[model samples]
Target: MRAMVIEENGGPEVLRPSEVPDPVPGPGEVVVDVTARGVNFIDIYQRSGLYEVPLPFVPGMEAAGVVTAVGEGVEDLSAGQRVGWAMAPGAYAERAAVKASLVVPVPDGVSDEQAAALLLQGMTAHSLTHSVHPVSEGETVLVHAAAGGTGLLLTQLAKARGARVIGTVSTEAKERIAREAGADEVVRYTETPVAEAVRELTGGEGVAAVYDGVGRDTFDAGLASLRPRGVLVLFGQSSGPVAPVDPQRLNAAGSVYLTRPSLAHFVADRQELLGRAGDLFSLLAQGRLDVRIGGRYPLADAGRAHTDLASRRTSGKLLLV
Candidate 1:
């Protein structure tokens, strides 16, 4: 098997492609013949040592593939079954060995590429709109980096729930993408002040909540864009991590609420994992959800994929095929 092995933590260049031994399934595990793998910020974090991992490891966290081998006591899943995982390490390879409990069956209509793309980002978006703050219909919400993968899905999900979504992007191209994803209004944060544009758009009143993934740089603006008592869900820190914040600042910001969530917490068990992924798959099967595969690269080009994603030069999902 060929894998993008990370022998050390550094830049994208650290992801070296090399022929490696195939993964063997342990008890209660299955070795998937990976057809597609999703590239996420977590992969970048792992590659850069921002998020620590043991040395000499594969970098991907999510993938979709066929079960090539099933381990002992794994009855529900079998060889040749189409399955996908939302949270699993060692996925950036031709094959991945994952616990049977963490794998979810992919339906017929959804392709391997779509399943790989949908699991991580799709579930994150679902957890945000459905669980985190629960955006109510007719309420206003703000989404930062709305042109990116999770941002685009969050925008559409928020709109599906009837929330008026206001998205912030750095470029005109991104603004258009956000608008197409059901964003009621798009603010070019690079040209106009995000909070000011948000305030002006709402006629002085602020949004009910802000979905902030671009931490650090947009933290203050997200806090300032909310209405009194509005929530700020800081999910990611693409630019950099946010500094330690004082609780009193929340009080000063009109008693606003702040939270940092992860997909692992929301999908803590197999039931929750399948439920969220099922919802996303159903939406995709019905044509209600459109997952854009922005770029596709062969396994050997994994380093370039990381470079493109880290540079924020691509939109939607980037897949390792």
Candidate 2:
């Protein structure tokens, strides 16, 4: 099988395309013939050595495909079934051996590309809005990078929950994308201070919550954009990791709550994994949720995909197909 192997961790160039052994199913695992793979910031973190992983590993964490083989003890899923998985490594390859429990059925209404695009970021958005802070009707929330994959999903989900969404972006194109995703207000952070704009949009009340995936650069802004006792969900560090803070800062920031969440913890249980993916697929099938595929690259162009995502010039999801 062909895979992008990270022999050493440093930059996008570190992802080298090479012929690797095809994956075979082990007990409780299934080998998938990957049709599409999602490129994400976590892959960049791994590639850049910000997040440690075993050397010479494949870089992707999510993919959608057809099941080529089923391992022992996997009764519910069979060969030829359509499936997708997130938080599972080795998806940058043509085939991946994923745990059967971690894989979710890809509904007939969704395409392999959409499944791959939405699984990781979609579920992350779901967990952030549904579990982390639980946006309520009439509550206003702030979403950083609102035109990005997870940010767009977060904006739509928050709006569906009846919350007024204030989104932060860097350009006019992104602001338009955020507004199309149902953001009530869009802030061009490059033009104005995000917190100040957020406060002004909410009439100085701030917001009920802030969903921040861009870390370090947007962390303080997120803290400042929250209302008293509001929560700040710091889920990713796309700009860079945040510096350690004194507990007093949280208190000074209107007693704001801060949480760093990962998709792994939210879908640790098989049932929870199925539930989140099912909800996303249902919404997609009903045409209520839109997943924008910003760029598509051949499997060997994984390095280019990483470069595009890190540059922040692309909006929505980037996929390897």
Q: Top model by lDDT, which number?
A: 2
lDDT of 2 at 192: 100
Cand. 1 TM to true fold:
0.99
For candidate 2, write residues 155-267 as lDDT tens digits.
99999999999999999999999999999999999999999988888899999998989999999999988889999899999999899989898999899898999889999
User: What is the TM-score of candidate 2?
Assistant: 0.99
Error of 1 at 145 (Å): 0.6
TM-score for each prediction? Answer: 0.99, 0.99
lDDT of 1 at 281: 95
Weakest 10 consecutive residues of candidate 1 by summed lDDT: 85-94
The segments of candidate 2 whose C-alpha lies over 4 angstroms from its true place after superposition are none
